[model samples]
Target: MLASVTGKGVCLCTILWILDTKGVFSLKNVTLSIEPSVVQYRNTSKLRCTYDLEGDALYTVKWYRGSLEFYRYTPSEKERDKRKQAFPFKGVTIDVDRSDSTQVTLNDIDFVVSGEFCCEVTTEDSHIHALNNCKSMVVVQLPEHPPEISVRGEPFDYGDILRANCSSYRSRPPADLTLILNGITVNQTEPLALRKLRPTDYSDLQLELKLSDLHFQEGQLNLQCVAQVSSVYHETVGLELQSVRHPVPEKVSAPNTASAASTASSQTIPLRLFCFTMLCFNAESVIKILIKTIPASCVTYYTVVATPVCDYTDIRINSLDKFYALIVVINLINIKMPHNDNPK
Candidate 1:
C-alpha cells in the first residue's frame, strides 16, 4: 500500500510538471518599466510592471524599493478597501489613489530615492507561481546654471599654444564635460578634476583643453564647451577667437632723372608763336634755314612748326629781318631747356 501511494504521488507531480511546460497557469514575459530612469530631484516618476498569466488569476502584485516593500495590490481581497494597501518606507512616497495592480506613481522624488526598484507578481493556484523583475533608477540634483568656459592666451595666432577650462557647479552626479573645436571633438588627455563641497553631497567637475600649433578657419577659431548630467540636463557655451598680427610697411622708389628730362624737352611752344613766324617767312626758306642752323637731332621742332601752318597756308615772306629774329629766339629757348647729362 505504501508503494502504491508513492506511485500515485509521483504521477501527480509529473502531471503538474507537464502542465507547467505547456504554459498553463504560469507567468510569462514579466517586465518592469521605469519612466525617466535618471530623474531630477523634486520631480515625479512612474514605475510599471507587466506580465502575462496564461490561464491563471493574479493573487497579489507588490512593489519594492530595494528590499523594502512599500505597496501591494490584492484583487482577490473580499473587502474593497483592503484590495490596495500602502506601507511606509523611507524615501518612497506612493500615490495610492493613482496606483493599481500594474503600476505605481512616485511624487516629489529626491536623491534618497535613487536605488533598485522591484515588482513581484503571484498567481492564485494550489501550486503557487511567482515572478519578479528589478530595474535601477537614479534621482539627481541638477546644476542650477549652465557650464562656464574660460579661455587663456587670448588673441590666438598660428603656431601658438591655446588653453581653455570648462567648469560645472555642484551636482549630485558631476556633469560630464567636452571640448569641441570647429565641430570636431577634442580629446582630453588629462584626467578630470573633481571637487566636493561641504554640507552637501553634490560635487563639481572641470575639464581642460590645451592645444598647440593652433589653426584657424577664415581668420577665426570656434570653441565650444558642453556639460551634461545623464539624459535630463545638457548645456553648451561657445567662444570665438581671432588671430592677431603686426602691420607691414610698403617700399618707396626714387624718381628717374632721364625720364624727367625727356618729359621737359618734349614741351611745345604756344601756337600763337608759330602763327607769327609763318607770317614773316616762306615755308621752304624757313625749312632750309632751320636744317642748317639746328642739329639733325633737333628736327622735331621744325616738324611741329610746319605741320599746322605750312600744310594749309599760302603766305608769302614779307621780311627777312623778322625771320632772323625768330631764329635767335628759338636758339635761346632751346639752351634753357633741361637735358640728361648721362645718355644711355
Candidate 2:
C-alpha cells in the first residue's frame, strides 16, 4: 500500500514540474516580400511571407489592419477559413503551410488592398514566448485617362496664327506626341529640323500650327491634332486633339491713323532703307512717309494705310504675334529715317 501511494505522489510531482518548465520557442528571421510593388490593371502578382522557428510549436496566427482582423489560422487545427471580412480584403486569398515554416500567399490585390500588415505567431519553449511582426504591402493603380491636348491660336479670319499643345499631365510615363496637319504628319520629331512648317511647343507635347498656307476654303479650315500616351500601368491611351477655327486674313483697303509697324527683321533694316529711297522717287510721298515711319510694327498694318499704291501685292506673312523672338527683333530695329528727306 505504501509503495502505491509513493508512485502516485511521484506522478503528481512530475506533472507540476513539466508545467513549470515550459520551453521557449520563437519565430526568428521573419521576412515578407512581394514580387512586384506596382501592380498593373487586371494582373497577377506573387507575395511571399516566411520565417524560421525553433520548433513545430502550434501557432495561433492572425492578420490584422489596425484594430480589425484580416485573417486567422490555428496551427493545431491547421485549417484555413478563407474569408475577406475586412474592408478591402474580401477579394484577397491566403495560403499557409507550417511544415516548411509558416508562409502566407496573398493574391488578387487592387488599389484598396494597399496598407500595413502584421503577422502574429505565438511560440513557446520550456522557457518563454513571443508576439508580433509587421510588414507592408503596396499596390499601384493604372492610369485612367490619356494625355489631353489643348490647341491655342487665333482662330477665325484667314491668317490668324494658332498655337497647339498636347500635354499628358496625369500620366506616369511621358507621352509620345504626333502632329497631324491637314491629313499629313507635316512635322517629324527632330531637333530644329525645318520646323517653320507649323507651330509647335517644344516644352509641351504641343504645337503652334500657323494658317500661313492654309486658306479659308469653302468656309473655314478644319484643324485637328492628337496626343498618344503609353503608361507604366500597361495601358495605352489616345486623346482627341483640340480643334480651333481661324479666319482667312482680310483683304485690306482701309486707311489707318496709327503708324504702321514693319515686320522686317533687323538684318533687313538696311534693305528697307534702300527700298524707301526708291519709293520716294517713283511713288507718292504718303507711301514714302510710311516706309520711314512703319518701323517696330507690322508692314501689313502700314501697307493697308500707306496710300492704295500696291493694292494687288499679296506677300502676306503672319502678323507679328507668332514668335516672341521675332517680335522683339522686328519691333526693335531702330531704323533711322529723317522726316526732312520725305519724297518731294
Candidate 3:
C-alpha cells in the first residue's frame, strides 16, 4: 500500500508540471512607464524607461518606438556583446552603460523622437513563458515663444469693453490661453491654430477675450494673459492702468481773476512740464497717449495712457504672483502746449 501511494504522488507531480508547461498556471505580470512623458526639442533632456516584472523567468526584454525596435535587454545572456547595443538604430543613441534589465536610458531626445513607446517581455521557456506588453506615448515639443497680447479694439479705458487678442506662437500641440483681471480668471478660450511657421513641426494658438464686466479698485485695473502649452510649460504677461487725482483749484473773485490767472499760468506750466518729464522717466513703454483738458485745474491734465505692446515669459513660480505688479505704470504728464494763433 505504501509503494502504491508513492507512485500516485509521483504521477500527480508530473501532471502538475505538464499543466504549468502548457500555461495553465501562468501568473506572469509586466508593467512599463516613461519618466517625464514630455520632452522639449533641441533641449538636452534624458528619458528613462522603467519596467517591472513578476512571476516569470525573463528571456528577453525589448523597447520599441512605433513598432521599430530600438533596444533589447537580455538577463540570461552571458556574452556582454549580446547584452545591449549603444546604437541600435542609426542616429538613435541609447546609454547602454546606464541601462540594465529593468530600465533603459536615452539622452539628447529631440522632436524626431516623439512616438508611442512600448516595452515587451517574453519568458525563457516557450511551454510556460507568458508574453506581456505595456506602452506609453511621448510628446516632443518645439521651443515656444512668449504669447503676444494686443488690444483688439479701442485701447483700454474704464467702463468699456476691453477686447484683446492673445497668441502663443511656434509651439507643438498649440497652447491654451486664459485672460485674468485682478487675480481672477475672467475668461478662458481654447487654442486656435495659426498659420504654420517655419520648422514645420510647430504651431501657434490665438485667443480673444471681450471683458465687458471689469471691477476697478482704487481707479486702477490689472490684466494678465496666461498661456499653457502643457502641464509642465506655461507663461504670462501683464498690464495695469491707474487714474490719478489732483486737487481742484479754488474759484477767485472777478477783480483778482486776472492776477490769479497770470500767477496760475506761470506756476502751472512748469509743474506740467515737470510731470511730463517724470512720466517719461517712470515708464519707457508709453505706446498710446490721450490728451484732455481739465477745466477745474485750469491747466490741462494729460492722462498719459500707455498700452501693453509685448509679452514676455516668466518661468519662475515665486515671481509669477508678482507679475501684474510689474505691469507698466501709468503716469499723468500735464503738459501745456503754448497757445499759438495758427490752429495747425
Error of 3 at 238 (Å): 1.9
Q: Write the per-residue lDDT of candidate 2 for residues 186-305, one digit (tens) a residue.
A: 442334243332221221355555554454444445444444332233322333322244344568986543334333223223322222221213445535555566555545444555
Off by over 4 Å in 1: 1-18, 21-25, 187-214, 245-344
lDDT of every predicted structure (CA atoms): 0.70, 0.46, 0.55
Winning model by TM-score: 1
Task: Return the TM-score for each candidate structure.
Answer: 0.61, 0.34, 0.54
**Model 3 Cα shift for residue 200 (angstroms):** 5.5
Which digits, one per residue and each the tens of the lDDT, describe model 1 over residues 1-344?
99999999999999989888655557877799999798888888889999999878888999988899989999988775688888886765788888999998988887888999999998876557789999999988878888777777777666666777777777767776777887777743233243334423333334344444444555667888787777888888898765564222356788888678656676422221222354344566656565455556656656655532222233333345734543212222222222466756
TM-score (C-alpha, index-matched) for candidate 1: 0.61
Ranking of models by TM-score: 1, 3, 2
The backbone clash count of each candidate, in order, is 0, 32, 0
RMSD of each: 20.1, 20.9, 18.9
Candidate 3: 10-residue stretch with minimal lDDT? 271-280
